[model samples]
Target: MSVTLARELACARSRLFGLRGVTIEQGRILLGALEACPRWRERPGIGELRIFRSAAGHEVLLVPSTGRVQIRVAYVVPPIERFDAAAGVLVELARLGRAARRAG
Candidate 1:
Protein backbone atom coordinates (compact mmCIF):
# COMPACT_ATOMS: atom_id res chain seq x y z
CA MET A 1 0.00 0.00 0.00
CA SER A 2 2.82 2.36 0.79
CA VAL A 3 4.44 1.54 -2.53
CA THR A 4 1.27 2.32 -4.43
CA LEU A 5 0.65 5.48 -2.42
CA ALA A 6 4.19 6.65 -3.06
CA ARG A 7 3.83 6.08 -6.77
CA GLU A 8 0.56 7.94 -6.86
CA LEU A 9 2.05 10.83 -4.91
CA ALA A 10 5.07 10.94 -7.20
CA CYS A 11 2.88 11.00 -10.26
CA ALA A 12 0.71 13.72 -8.76
CA ARG A 13 3.75 15.80 -7.92
CA SER A 14 5.16 15.45 -11.38
CA ARG A 15 2.01 15.73 -13.42
CA LEU A 16 0.03 18.22 -11.37
CA PHE A 17 2.78 20.35 -9.92
CA GLY A 18 5.21 20.09 -12.83
CA LEU A 19 7.89 18.86 -10.48
CA ARG A 20 10.72 17.35 -12.47
CA GLY A 21 11.42 14.72 -9.89
CA VAL A 22 10.70 14.05 -6.24
CA THR A 23 13.63 12.37 -4.55
CA ILE A 24 13.09 9.29 -2.44
CA GLU A 25 14.32 11.16 0.59
CA GLN A 26 11.76 13.93 0.08
CA GLY A 27 9.02 11.40 -0.47
CA ARG A 28 10.00 9.60 2.70
CA ILE A 29 10.05 12.85 4.62
CA LEU A 30 6.62 13.85 3.37
CA LEU A 31 5.19 10.43 4.05
CA GLY A 32 6.78 10.41 7.47
CA ALA A 33 5.14 13.73 8.25
CA LEU A 34 1.78 12.38 7.16
CA GLU A 35 2.24 9.22 9.18
CA ALA A 36 3.16 11.21 12.24
CA CYS A 37 -0.23 12.89 12.32
CA PRO A 38 -2.41 11.29 15.00
CA ARG A 39 -5.52 11.71 12.88
CA TRP A 40 -3.87 10.62 9.69
CA ARG A 41 -6.40 7.85 9.21
CA GLU A 42 -9.34 10.24 9.31
CA ARG A 43 -8.85 11.45 5.79
CA PRO A 44 -10.25 14.93 5.31
CA GLY A 45 -12.02 15.85 2.14
CA ILE A 46 -10.19 18.10 -0.30
CA GLY A 47 -12.62 20.94 0.30
CA GLU A 48 -11.64 20.89 3.94
CA LEU A 49 -7.93 21.19 3.27
CA ARG A 50 -6.48 24.60 3.99
CA ILE A 51 -3.44 26.38 2.63
CA PHE A 52 -1.93 29.24 4.54
CA ARG A 53 1.22 31.30 4.54
CA SER A 54 3.35 31.04 7.63
CA ALA A 55 4.95 34.07 9.22
CA ALA A 56 8.28 32.84 7.87
CA GLY A 57 6.74 32.89 4.39
CA HIS A 58 6.31 29.17 3.96
CA GLU A 59 3.26 27.59 2.42
CA VAL A 60 1.54 25.34 4.94
CA LEU A 61 -0.87 22.52 4.26
CA LEU A 62 -3.37 22.21 7.06
CA VAL A 63 -5.83 19.36 7.50
CA PRO A 64 -8.56 19.96 10.05
CA SER A 65 -9.96 16.96 11.84
CA THR A 66 -12.23 16.31 14.80
CA GLY A 67 -10.01 17.04 17.78
CA ARG A 68 -6.57 17.45 16.27
CA VAL A 69 -5.05 19.50 13.47
CA GLN A 70 -2.84 17.83 10.90
CA ILE A 71 -0.25 19.77 9.01
CA ARG A 72 0.74 17.73 6.00
CA VAL A 73 3.31 19.77 4.09
CA ALA A 74 5.29 22.94 4.41
CA TYR A 75 7.15 24.42 1.44
CA VAL A 76 9.99 26.72 2.41
CA VAL A 77 9.95 28.88 -0.66
CA PRO A 78 7.62 31.89 -0.70
CA PRO A 79 7.34 32.36 -4.43
CA ILE A 80 3.85 32.20 -5.81
CA GLU A 81 4.82 29.49 -8.26
CA ARG A 82 6.24 27.29 -5.54
CA PHE A 83 3.23 27.91 -3.34
CA ASP A 84 0.90 26.99 -6.19
CA ALA A 85 2.84 23.84 -6.88
CA ALA A 86 2.86 22.84 -3.23
CA ALA A 87 -0.84 23.53 -2.92
CA GLY A 88 -1.56 21.46 -5.99
CA VAL A 89 0.38 18.52 -4.64
CA LEU A 90 -1.38 18.88 -1.29
CA VAL A 91 -4.81 18.94 -2.88
CA GLU A 92 -3.95 15.82 -4.82
CA LEU A 93 -2.79 14.12 -1.67
CA ALA A 94 -6.02 14.97 0.09
CA ARG A 95 -8.05 13.67 -2.84
CA LEU A 96 -6.12 10.42 -2.94
CA GLY A 97 -6.26 9.98 0.81
CA ARG A 98 -10.00 10.55 0.84
CA ALA A 99 -10.55 8.02 -1.93
CA ALA A 100 -8.37 5.45 -0.21
CA ARG A 101 -10.24 5.88 3.05
CA ARG A 102 -13.60 5.51 1.36
CA ALA A 103 -12.46 2.42 -0.48
CA GLY A 104 -11.19 0.79 2.62
Candidate 2:
Protein backbone atom coordinates (compact mmCIF):
# COMPACT_ATOMS: atom_id res chain seq x y z
CA MET A 1 0.00 0.00 0.00
CA SER A 2 2.73 2.45 0.90
CA VAL A 3 4.68 1.51 -2.21
CA THR A 4 1.55 2.04 -4.28
CA LEU A 5 1.11 5.58 -3.00
CA ALA A 6 4.75 6.33 -3.57
CA ARG A 7 4.51 5.08 -7.15
CA GLU A 8 1.47 7.27 -7.76
CA LEU A 9 3.30 10.29 -6.45
CA ALA A 10 6.28 9.47 -8.64
CA CYS A 11 4.02 9.18 -11.66
CA ALA A 12 2.43 12.54 -10.95
CA ARG A 13 5.81 14.17 -10.52
CA SER A 14 7.03 12.56 -13.73
CA ARG A 15 4.23 14.29 -15.63
CA LEU A 16 5.37 17.62 -14.25
CA PHE A 17 8.90 16.79 -15.34
CA GLY A 18 7.65 16.36 -18.91
CA LEU A 19 6.96 20.08 -19.13
CA ARG A 20 10.59 20.74 -18.24
CA GLY A 21 11.83 18.18 -20.75
CA VAL A 22 13.09 16.06 -17.88
CA THR A 23 13.51 12.42 -18.69
CA ILE A 24 14.17 9.29 -16.67
CA GLU A 25 17.87 9.70 -17.35
CA GLN A 26 17.71 13.27 -16.12
CA GLY A 27 15.85 12.04 -13.11
CA ARG A 28 18.75 9.71 -12.38
CA ILE A 29 21.12 12.66 -12.32
CA LEU A 30 18.83 14.55 -10.01
CA LEU A 31 18.55 11.49 -7.86
CA GLY A 32 22.29 11.18 -7.69
CA ALA A 33 22.56 14.76 -6.59
CA LEU A 34 19.83 14.22 -4.03
CA GLU A 35 21.72 11.31 -2.53
CA ALA A 36 24.53 13.71 -1.79
CA CYS A 37 22.36 15.50 0.76
CA PRO A 38 23.66 15.39 4.30
CA ARG A 39 23.05 12.11 6.15
CA TRP A 40 21.13 10.27 3.47
CA ARG A 41 21.57 6.67 2.32
CA GLU A 42 19.95 3.99 0.22
CA ARG A 43 20.53 0.24 0.51
CA PRO A 44 19.18 -2.76 -1.35
CA GLY A 45 15.65 -2.77 -0.02
CA ILE A 46 12.11 -2.41 -1.22
CA GLY A 47 11.21 0.02 -3.99
CA GLU A 48 10.23 3.58 -3.15
CA LEU A 49 8.98 6.80 -4.64
CA ARG A 50 11.00 9.93 -3.83
CA ILE A 51 9.10 13.18 -4.07
CA PHE A 52 9.98 16.88 -3.97
CA ARG A 53 9.12 20.30 -5.40
CA SER A 54 11.68 22.41 -7.19
CA ALA A 55 12.06 26.06 -6.24
CA ALA A 56 10.16 26.92 -9.41
CA GLY A 57 7.26 24.80 -8.15
CA HIS A 58 7.99 21.95 -10.47
CA GLU A 59 7.66 18.54 -8.91
CA VAL A 60 10.93 16.67 -8.42
CA LEU A 61 9.99 13.04 -8.55
CA LEU A 62 12.01 9.85 -8.22
CA VAL A 63 11.52 6.13 -8.11
CA PRO A 64 14.06 3.62 -7.00
CA SER A 65 16.11 2.98 -10.13
CA THR A 66 17.14 -0.49 -9.14
CA GLY A 67 15.57 -3.87 -8.72
CA ARG A 68 14.15 -5.00 -5.40
CA VAL A 69 17.26 -7.04 -4.84
CA GLN A 70 19.30 -3.94 -5.56
CA ILE A 71 17.05 -1.18 -4.29
CA ARG A 72 18.26 2.40 -4.54
CA VAL A 73 16.91 4.93 -2.08
CA ALA A 74 18.67 8.08 -0.83
CA TYR A 75 21.59 9.17 1.30
CA VAL A 76 19.51 9.23 4.42
CA VAL A 77 18.22 6.00 5.75
CA PRO A 78 14.50 6.51 5.40
CA PRO A 79 12.45 6.42 8.54
CA ILE A 80 9.15 4.80 7.84
CA GLU A 81 7.39 7.74 9.45
CA ARG A 82 9.68 10.40 8.04
CA PHE A 83 9.15 9.96 4.36
CA ASP A 84 8.98 13.72 3.82
CA ALA A 85 12.72 13.90 4.42
CA ALA A 86 13.20 12.68 0.87
CA ALA A 87 11.57 15.82 -0.45
CA GLY A 88 14.00 18.00 1.39
CA VAL A 89 16.89 16.04 -0.08
CA LEU A 90 15.53 16.65 -3.56
CA VAL A 91 15.47 20.37 -2.89
CA GLU A 92 19.05 20.22 -1.71
CA LEU A 93 20.03 18.29 -4.83
CA ALA A 94 18.37 20.81 -7.08
CA ARG A 95 20.07 23.60 -5.23
CA LEU A 96 23.44 22.00 -5.78
CA GLY A 97 22.75 21.67 -9.48
CA ARG A 98 21.69 25.29 -9.75
CA ALA A 99 24.76 26.41 -7.87
CA ALA A 100 26.93 24.42 -10.20
CA ARG A 101 25.22 26.08 -13.13
CA ARG A 102 25.99 29.52 -11.68
CA ALA A 103 29.59 28.54 -11.08
CA GLY A 104 29.98 27.16 -14.56
Candidate 3:
Protein backbone atom coordinates (compact mmCIF):
# COMPACT_ATOMS: atom_id res chain seq x y z
CA MET A 1 0.00 0.00 0.00
CA SER A 2 1.08 3.57 -0.59
CA VAL A 3 2.25 5.66 2.33
CA THR A 4 -0.82 7.91 1.93
CA LEU A 5 -3.18 4.95 2.15
CA ALA A 6 -1.42 3.61 5.19
CA ARG A 7 -1.62 7.01 6.82
CA GLU A 8 -5.32 7.23 6.04
CA LEU A 9 -5.93 3.84 7.59
CA ALA A 10 -4.00 4.81 10.67
CA CYS A 11 -5.97 8.03 10.92
CA ALA A 12 -9.23 6.14 10.74
CA ARG A 13 -8.13 3.69 13.36
CA SER A 14 -7.00 6.48 15.62
CA ARG A 15 -10.34 8.23 15.23
CA LEU A 16 -12.20 5.08 16.17
CA PHE A 17 -9.97 4.32 19.11
CA GLY A 18 -9.62 7.85 20.41
CA LEU A 19 -13.29 8.82 20.41
CA ARG A 20 -13.58 8.92 24.16
CA GLY A 21 -10.57 11.15 24.51
CA VAL A 22 -11.85 13.36 21.72
CA THR A 23 -15.15 13.86 23.49
CA ILE A 24 -13.41 14.79 26.70
CA GLU A 25 -11.32 17.26 24.76
CA GLN A 26 -14.43 18.73 23.25
CA GLY A 27 -16.02 19.03 26.64
CA ARG A 28 -12.94 20.73 27.99
CA ILE A 29 -12.96 23.13 25.06
CA LEU A 30 -16.61 23.92 25.62
CA LEU A 31 -16.00 24.44 29.28
CA GLY A 32 -13.01 26.59 28.44
CA ALA A 33 -14.98 28.82 26.11
CA LEU A 34 -17.19 29.76 29.02
CA GLU A 35 -14.49 30.10 31.63
CA ALA A 36 -11.88 32.09 29.71
CA CYS A 37 -14.13 34.89 28.56
CA PRO A 38 -14.63 37.24 31.49
CA ARG A 39 -17.71 38.61 29.78
CA TRP A 40 -19.36 35.27 30.27
CA ARG A 41 -18.31 35.08 33.90
CA GLU A 42 -20.33 37.68 35.74
CA ARG A 43 -23.67 38.18 33.95
CA PRO A 44 -23.47 35.64 31.09
CA GLY A 45 -26.15 37.17 28.97
CA ILE A 46 -27.22 34.82 26.19
CA GLY A 47 -25.30 31.63 26.79
CA GLU A 48 -26.70 28.77 28.82
CA LEU A 49 -24.97 26.02 30.79
CA ARG A 50 -25.99 22.37 30.93
CA ILE A 51 -24.57 18.89 30.58
CA PHE A 52 -25.75 16.60 27.80
CA ARG A 53 -24.66 13.67 25.66
CA SER A 54 -23.45 14.05 22.11
CA ALA A 55 -24.65 12.04 19.15
CA ALA A 56 -21.27 10.31 19.18
CA GLY A 57 -22.13 8.78 22.57
CA HIS A 58 -19.82 11.14 24.45
CA GLU A 59 -20.89 13.36 27.29
CA VAL A 60 -20.40 17.10 26.94
CA LEU A 61 -21.68 20.34 28.34
CA LEU A 62 -23.03 23.14 26.16
CA VAL A 63 -22.37 26.77 26.89
CA PRO A 64 -23.60 29.26 24.32
CA SER A 65 -21.57 32.46 23.94
CA THR A 66 -24.09 34.66 22.28
CA GLY A 67 -26.51 37.47 23.03
CA ARG A 68 -25.31 38.94 26.30
CA VAL A 69 -21.98 37.88 27.84
CA GLN A 70 -23.16 34.78 29.66
CA ILE A 71 -22.45 31.08 29.41
CA ARG A 72 -25.91 29.83 28.59
CA VAL A 73 -26.64 26.12 28.51
CA ALA A 74 -28.62 24.50 25.69
CA TYR A 75 -28.39 20.78 26.50
CA VAL A 76 -28.10 19.66 22.88
CA VAL A 77 -25.65 18.67 20.19
CA PRO A 78 -23.05 20.75 18.33
CA PRO A 79 -23.25 23.06 21.39
CA ILE A 80 -24.64 25.81 19.20
CA GLU A 81 -21.57 27.80 18.08
CA ARG A 82 -19.33 26.87 20.97
CA PHE A 83 -16.42 25.46 18.97
CA ASP A 84 -15.77 28.99 17.75
CA ALA A 85 -16.38 30.83 20.98
CA ALA A 86 -13.62 32.81 22.64
CA ALA A 87 -11.19 31.47 25.24
CA GLY A 88 -13.58 31.82 28.15
CA VAL A 89 -14.25 28.14 28.29
CA LEU A 90 -10.59 27.32 27.77
CA VAL A 91 -9.58 29.89 30.38
CA GLU A 92 -11.77 28.12 32.85
CA LEU A 93 -10.34 24.82 31.69
CA ALA A 94 -6.85 26.10 32.45
CA ARG A 95 -7.86 26.85 35.99
CA LEU A 96 -9.48 23.46 36.29
CA GLY A 97 -6.43 21.85 34.77
CA ARG A 98 -4.29 23.51 37.40
CA ALA A 99 -6.61 22.34 40.13
CA ALA A 100 -6.58 18.80 38.80
CA ARG A 101 -2.83 18.83 38.53
CA ARG A 102 -2.55 20.01 42.10
CA ALA A 103 -4.97 17.36 43.28
CA GLY A 104 -3.22 14.65 41.38
Candidate 4:
Protein backbone atom coordinates (compact mmCIF):
# COMPACT_ATOMS: atom_id res chain seq x y z
CA MET A 1 0.00 0.00 0.00
CA SER A 2 2.81 2.37 0.86
CA VAL A 3 4.50 1.63 -2.43
CA THR A 4 1.35 2.34 -4.36
CA LEU A 5 0.73 5.42 -2.28
CA ALA A 6 4.22 6.61 -3.01
CA ARG A 7 3.79 6.09 -6.71
CA GLU A 8 0.45 7.83 -6.74
CA LEU A 9 1.87 10.71 -4.79
CA ALA A 10 4.73 10.97 -7.21
CA CYS A 11 2.42 11.20 -10.21
CA ALA A 12 -0.50 12.97 -8.62
CA ARG A 13 -1.91 16.09 -10.25
CA SER A 14 -3.55 18.80 -8.19
CA ARG A 15 -6.00 21.27 -9.63
CA LEU A 16 -8.98 23.19 -8.40
CA PHE A 17 -11.65 22.05 -10.80
CA GLY A 18 -10.27 22.66 -14.30
CA LEU A 19 -8.40 25.80 -13.53
CA ARG A 20 -4.69 25.06 -13.94
CA GLY A 21 -3.84 26.86 -10.76
CA VAL A 22 -2.22 24.08 -8.80
CA THR A 23 0.63 22.45 -10.60
CA ILE A 24 1.70 18.83 -10.53
CA GLU A 25 4.82 19.88 -8.65
CA GLN A 26 2.71 21.41 -5.91
CA GLY A 27 0.57 18.32 -5.67
CA ARG A 28 3.57 16.03 -5.40
CA ILE A 29 5.06 18.16 -2.66
CA LEU A 30 1.78 18.37 -0.74
CA LEU A 31 1.18 14.66 -0.99
CA GLY A 32 4.68 13.95 0.26
CA ALA A 33 4.01 16.17 3.25
CA LEU A 34 0.81 14.27 3.97
CA GLU A 35 2.62 10.96 3.86
CA ALA A 36 5.25 12.29 6.23
CA CYS A 37 2.84 13.75 8.75
CA PRO A 38 1.83 11.71 11.80
CA ARG A 39 -1.22 13.83 12.61
CA TRP A 40 -3.35 12.36 9.86
CA ARG A 41 -6.24 10.16 10.96
CA GLU A 42 -8.74 8.19 8.99
CA ARG A 43 -11.87 10.28 8.92
CA PRO A 44 -14.91 8.59 10.43
CA GLY A 45 -17.83 7.66 8.17
CA ILE A 46 -15.47 7.11 5.27
CA GLY A 47 -13.47 3.97 4.74
CA GLU A 48 -10.83 5.41 2.44
CA LEU A 49 -10.77 9.03 3.43
CA ARG A 50 -8.02 10.51 5.58
CA ILE A 51 -7.80 14.02 6.93
CA PHE A 52 -5.05 16.19 8.33
CA ARG A 53 -5.53 19.44 10.13
CA SER A 54 -2.61 21.75 10.58
CA ALA A 55 -2.03 23.93 13.60
CA ALA A 56 -2.87 26.88 11.42
CA GLY A 57 -6.43 25.51 10.93
CA HIS A 58 -6.03 24.34 7.36
CA GLU A 59 -7.88 21.11 6.68
CA VAL A 60 -6.55 18.78 4.05
CA LEU A 61 -8.69 15.91 2.83
CA LEU A 62 -7.25 12.95 1.01
CA VAL A 63 -9.11 10.11 -0.64
CA PRO A 64 -6.72 7.33 -1.54
CA SER A 65 -7.17 5.32 -4.69
CA THR A 66 -5.17 2.85 -6.76
CA GLY A 67 -5.22 5.09 -9.80
CA ARG A 68 -5.17 8.58 -8.37
CA VAL A 69 -5.93 10.03 -4.99
CA GLN A 70 -8.05 13.13 -4.80
CA ILE A 71 -6.63 15.80 -2.50
CA ARG A 72 -8.51 18.83 -1.35
CA VAL A 73 -7.22 21.66 0.79
CA ALA A 74 -9.56 23.94 2.65
CA TYR A 75 -8.55 27.07 4.44
CA VAL A 76 -10.38 28.42 7.46
CA VAL A 77 -9.83 31.75 5.80
CA PRO A 78 -10.03 31.40 2.08
CA PRO A 79 -7.10 32.78 0.13
CA ILE A 80 -7.19 34.64 -3.14
CA GLU A 81 -6.33 31.46 -4.99
CA ARG A 82 -6.68 27.97 -3.57
CA PHE A 83 -3.56 26.90 -5.39
CA ASP A 84 -1.51 29.67 -3.84
CA ALA A 85 -2.50 28.48 -0.35
CA ALA A 86 -1.25 24.91 -0.50
CA ALA A 87 2.41 25.80 -0.08
CA GLY A 88 1.82 27.34 3.32
CA VAL A 89 -0.14 24.33 4.46
CA LEU A 90 2.49 21.98 3.13
CA VAL A 91 5.25 23.79 4.98
CA GLU A 92 3.35 23.73 8.27
CA LEU A 93 2.50 20.06 7.97
CA ALA A 94 6.07 19.16 7.14
CA ARG A 95 7.28 21.10 10.14
CA LEU A 96 4.78 19.32 12.36
CA GLY A 97 5.93 15.97 11.05
CA ARG A 98 9.52 16.81 11.78
CA ALA A 99 8.69 17.89 15.32
CA ALA A 100 6.73 14.72 15.95
CA ARG A 101 9.54 12.55 14.71
CA ARG A 102 12.03 14.35 16.89
CA ALA A 103 9.85 14.09 20.00
CA GLY A 104 9.21 10.42 19.45
Candidate 5:
Protein backbone atom coordinates (compact mmCIF):
# COMPACT_ATOMS: atom_id res chain seq x y z
CA MET A 1 0.00 0.00 0.00
CA SER A 2 1.10 3.53 -0.77
CA VAL A 3 1.89 5.85 2.11
CA THR A 4 -0.99 8.11 1.24
CA LEU A 5 -3.40 5.23 1.08
CA ALA A 6 -2.16 3.81 4.34
CA ARG A 7 -2.73 7.15 5.97
CA GLU A 8 -6.17 7.42 4.38
CA LEU A 9 -7.11 3.99 5.60
CA ALA A 10 -6.07 4.91 9.08
CA CYS A 11 -8.26 7.97 8.94
CA ALA A 12 -11.09 5.89 7.61
CA ARG A 13 -10.75 3.44 10.47
CA SER A 14 -10.89 6.31 12.92
CA ARG A 15 -13.96 7.68 11.19
CA LEU A 16 -15.66 4.33 11.18
CA PHE A 17 -15.03 3.77 14.87
CA GLY A 18 -18.23 3.65 16.89
CA LEU A 19 -20.53 4.25 13.95
CA ARG A 20 -23.81 2.40 14.09
CA GLY A 21 -24.47 -0.61 11.81
CA VAL A 22 -20.76 -1.18 11.24
CA THR A 23 -18.81 -2.93 13.94
CA ILE A 24 -15.08 -2.35 14.42
CA GLU A 25 -14.38 -5.88 13.30
CA GLN A 26 -16.59 -5.46 10.26
CA GLY A 27 -14.81 -2.23 9.44
CA ARG A 28 -11.48 -4.02 9.57
CA ILE A 29 -12.74 -6.77 7.28
CA LEU A 30 -14.17 -4.22 4.86
CA LEU A 31 -10.89 -2.33 4.76
CA GLY A 32 -9.01 -5.56 4.30
CA ALA A 33 -11.18 -6.30 1.31
CA LEU A 34 -10.37 -2.86 -0.09
CA GLU A 35 -6.66 -3.47 0.31
CA ALA A 36 -6.91 -6.87 -1.36
CA CYS A 37 -8.51 -5.63 -4.57
CA PRO A 38 -6.71 -3.51 -7.11
CA ARG A 39 -7.73 0.09 -7.37
CA TRP A 40 -10.48 0.86 -9.88
CA ARG A 41 -10.13 4.63 -10.12
CA GLU A 42 -9.08 7.78 -8.31
CA ARG A 43 -11.82 10.33 -8.35
CA PRO A 44 -10.11 13.60 -9.16
CA GLY A 45 -10.21 16.33 -6.50
CA ILE A 46 -10.99 13.80 -3.78
CA GLY A 47 -8.33 13.34 -1.13
CA GLU A 48 -7.20 9.77 -0.66
CA LEU A 49 -10.39 8.15 -1.84
CA ARG A 50 -9.87 4.51 -2.69
CA ILE A 51 -12.30 2.68 -4.93
CA PHE A 52 -11.82 -0.98 -5.75
CA ARG A 53 -13.86 -3.33 -7.90
CA SER A 54 -13.14 -7.03 -8.06
CA ALA A 55 -13.56 -8.93 -11.34
CA ALA A 56 -16.36 -10.91 -9.76
CA GLY A 57 -18.20 -7.57 -9.28
CA HIS A 58 -17.70 -6.99 -5.57
CA GLU A 59 -16.89 -3.38 -4.74
CA VAL A 60 -15.25 -1.53 -1.89
CA LEU A 61 -16.50 2.00 -2.14
CA LEU A 62 -14.46 3.98 0.32
CA VAL A 63 -14.73 7.55 1.48
CA PRO A 64 -16.44 10.76 0.34
CA SER A 65 -18.63 9.36 -2.47
CA THR A 66 -21.55 8.55 -0.20
CA GLY A 67 -20.05 10.58 2.62
CA ARG A 68 -19.34 7.15 4.14
CA VAL A 69 -17.58 3.88 3.38
CA GLN A 70 -19.67 1.01 2.08
CA ILE A 71 -19.41 -2.37 0.49
CA ARG A 72 -21.79 -2.95 -2.38
CA VAL A 73 -21.86 -6.65 -1.72
CA ALA A 74 -23.25 -9.28 -4.06
CA TYR A 75 -26.05 -10.72 -1.96
CA VAL A 76 -25.81 -14.15 -3.50
CA VAL A 77 -22.36 -14.60 -1.99
CA PRO A 78 -21.72 -15.18 1.66
CA PRO A 79 -19.24 -12.80 3.36
CA ILE A 80 -16.48 -15.31 4.13
CA GLU A 81 -16.74 -17.05 0.76
CA ARG A 82 -16.88 -13.74 -1.06
CA PHE A 83 -13.64 -12.49 0.49
CA ASP A 84 -11.98 -15.86 -0.09
CA ALA A 85 -12.86 -15.65 -3.77
CA ALA A 86 -11.67 -12.07 -3.88
CA ALA A 87 -8.29 -13.10 -2.49
CA GLY A 88 -7.93 -15.65 -5.27
CA VAL A 89 -8.79 -13.08 -7.94
CA LEU A 90 -6.34 -10.59 -6.43
CA VAL A 91 -3.54 -13.13 -6.41
CA GLU A 92 -4.10 -13.86 -10.10
CA LEU A 93 -4.22 -10.19 -10.94
CA ALA A 94 -0.98 -9.57 -9.08
CA ARG A 95 0.71 -12.40 -10.94
CA LEU A 96 -0.53 -10.97 -14.23
CA GLY A 97 0.69 -7.51 -13.31
CA ARG A 98 4.13 -8.82 -12.50
CA ALA A 99 4.30 -10.86 -15.70
CA ALA A 100 3.24 -7.89 -17.81
CA ARG A 101 5.83 -5.69 -16.20
CA ARG A 102 8.56 -8.27 -16.87
CA ALA A 103 7.44 -8.80 -20.47
CA GLY A 104 7.37 -5.09 -21.15
Candidate 6:
Protein backbone atom coordinates (compact mmCIF):
# COMPACT_ATOMS: atom_id res chain seq x y z
CA MET A 1 0.00 0.00 0.00
CA SER A 2 1.02 3.60 -0.48
CA VAL A 3 2.49 5.49 2.43
CA THR A 4 -0.46 7.82 2.64
CA LEU A 5 -2.84 4.92 2.74
CA ALA A 6 -0.71 3.18 5.29
CA ARG A 7 -0.72 6.27 7.49
CA GLU A 8 -4.45 6.57 7.24
CA LEU A 9 -4.85 2.98 8.25
CA ALA A 10 -2.51 3.49 11.16
CA CYS A 11 -4.43 6.48 12.41
CA ALA A 12 -7.71 4.68 12.13
CA ARG A 13 -6.31 1.71 13.96
CA SER A 14 -4.94 3.99 16.66
CA ARG A 15 -8.35 5.50 17.17
CA LEU A 16 -9.86 2.06 17.49
CA PHE A 17 -7.36 1.22 20.18
CA GLY A 18 -8.10 4.45 21.98
CA LEU A 19 -11.78 3.60 22.10
CA ARG A 20 -10.86 0.28 23.63
CA GLY A 21 -8.95 2.09 26.38
CA VAL A 22 -5.50 1.43 24.92
CA THR A 23 -3.06 4.14 23.92
CA ILE A 24 -1.39 3.60 20.57
CA GLU A 25 1.27 6.18 19.85
CA GLN A 26 4.04 3.65 20.29
CA GLY A 27 2.11 1.20 18.20
CA ARG A 28 1.87 3.83 15.48
CA ILE A 29 5.58 4.41 15.68
CA LEU A 30 6.29 0.72 15.15
CA LEU A 31 3.73 0.57 12.39
CA GLY A 32 5.42 3.51 10.71
CA ALA A 33 8.73 1.72 10.92
CA LEU A 34 7.25 -1.41 9.42
CA GLU A 35 5.66 0.64 6.64
CA ALA A 36 8.91 2.43 5.88
CA CYS A 37 11.20 -0.60 6.14
CA PRO A 38 8.97 -3.66 5.66
CA ARG A 39 11.52 -5.87 7.36
CA TRP A 40 9.66 -7.05 10.43
CA ARG A 41 9.68 -10.63 11.66
CA GLU A 42 6.54 -12.25 12.98
CA ARG A 43 6.45 -13.91 16.38
CA PRO A 44 3.17 -15.72 16.37
CA GLY A 45 3.27 -17.43 19.74
CA ILE A 46 4.96 -14.68 21.66
CA GLY A 47 2.38 -12.01 21.01
CA GLU A 48 0.89 -12.58 17.60
CA LEU A 49 2.78 -9.56 16.38
CA ARG A 50 6.01 -8.48 14.69
CA ILE A 51 9.43 -7.25 15.71
CA PHE A 52 11.78 -4.83 14.01
CA ARG A 53 14.52 -2.32 14.63
CA SER A 54 13.78 1.34 14.34
CA ALA A 55 16.13 3.64 12.45
CA ALA A 56 17.51 4.60 15.85
CA GLY A 57 18.90 1.13 16.56
CA HIS A 58 16.19 0.46 19.15
CA GLU A 59 14.18 -2.71 19.11
CA VAL A 60 10.48 -2.03 18.66
CA LEU A 61 8.33 -4.92 19.71
CA LEU A 62 4.73 -4.58 18.68
CA VAL A 63 1.89 -6.73 19.96
CA PRO A 64 -0.96 -6.22 17.62
CA SER A 65 -3.29 -8.45 19.55
CA THR A 66 -2.87 -6.32 22.64
CA GLY A 67 -2.13 -2.98 21.02
CA ARG A 68 1.01 -2.84 23.11
CA VAL A 69 4.32 -1.49 21.85
CA GLN A 70 7.65 -1.66 23.59
CA ILE A 71 10.82 0.25 22.77
CA ARG A 72 14.04 -1.25 24.02
CA VAL A 73 17.29 0.65 24.05
CA ALA A 74 20.45 -1.13 25.09
CA TYR A 75 22.53 0.27 27.91
CA VAL A 76 25.85 -0.33 26.29
CA VAL A 77 27.31 3.13 26.80
CA PRO A 78 25.12 4.93 29.31
CA PRO A 79 21.42 4.77 30.09
CA ILE A 80 20.75 8.37 29.19
CA GLU A 81 22.85 8.45 26.05
CA ARG A 82 21.54 5.18 24.73
CA PHE A 83 17.82 5.92 25.09
CA ASP A 84 18.03 9.60 24.18
CA ALA A 85 20.18 9.12 21.09
CA ALA A 86 18.45 6.02 19.85
CA ALA A 87 14.95 7.32 20.56
CA GLY A 88 15.82 10.58 18.82
CA VAL A 89 16.99 8.77 15.75
CA LEU A 90 13.95 6.52 15.75
CA VAL A 91 11.55 9.45 16.04
CA GLU A 92 13.32 11.41 13.28
CA LEU A 93 13.33 8.42 10.95
CA ALA A 94 9.66 7.76 11.60
CA ARG A 95 8.82 11.37 10.80
CA LEU A 96 10.94 11.42 7.65
CA GLY A 97 9.57 8.11 6.50
CA ARG A 98 6.01 9.31 6.89
CA ALA A 99 6.79 12.59 5.13
CA ALA A 100 8.57 10.85 2.31
CA ARG A 101 5.59 8.63 1.75
CA ARG A 102 3.17 11.54 1.72
CA ALA A 103 5.39 13.45 -0.70
CA GLY A 104 5.66 10.45 -2.93
Q: Which candidate is the best by TM-score?
A: 6
State the C-alpha lDDT per candidate: 0.39, 0.39, 0.32, 0.44, 0.41, 0.44
Question: Roughly what TM-score does model 5 have, to 2 decimal places?
Answer: 0.34
Total colliding residue pairs, candidate 3 = 23
User: Candidate 2, which ten residues in sequence have the lowest lDDT sum?
Assistant: 1-10
Better of 4 and 6 by TM-score: 6
Pick the winner on TM-score between candidates 2 and 3: 2
TM-score of predicted model 2? Answer: 0.31
Clashing pairs in 2: 40-75, 40-76, 41-74, 41-75, 41-76
Deviation from native of the Cα of residue 8 in model 3, angstroms: 20
**What are the C-alpha RMSDs, in order, of all predicted structures?**
12.4, 11.1, 14.5, 9.4, 11.6, 10.6
Where model 6 places Cα greater than 4 Å from the true spot, the runs are: 1-45, 54-57, 96-104
Instruction: Give a tens-digit lDDT track for model 4, residues 1-104.
Output: 11111111222243221212334444444456566666554335366555555554445654444223333444344545545556555455446545544555
Q: Candidate 3's residue-wise lDDT over 10-97, tens digit each?
A: 2212211111122344445445543543433333223365443223333223433321112222223244343322133334444554
lDDT of 1 at 87: 57
Question: What digit string (tens of lDDT, one per residue) describes model 1 on residues 1-104?
Answer: 13221211332232223222334443434444455444334333467554433333333344333212222233444334544545554565455445555544
lDDT minimum window of 10 residues, candidate 3:
1-10
lDDT of 3 at 59: 27
Name the weakest run of 10 consecutive residues (lDDT summed) in model 5. 1-10
Model 5 residue 68 CA deviation (Å) reads 18
Tell me the lDDT of model 6 at 31: 61
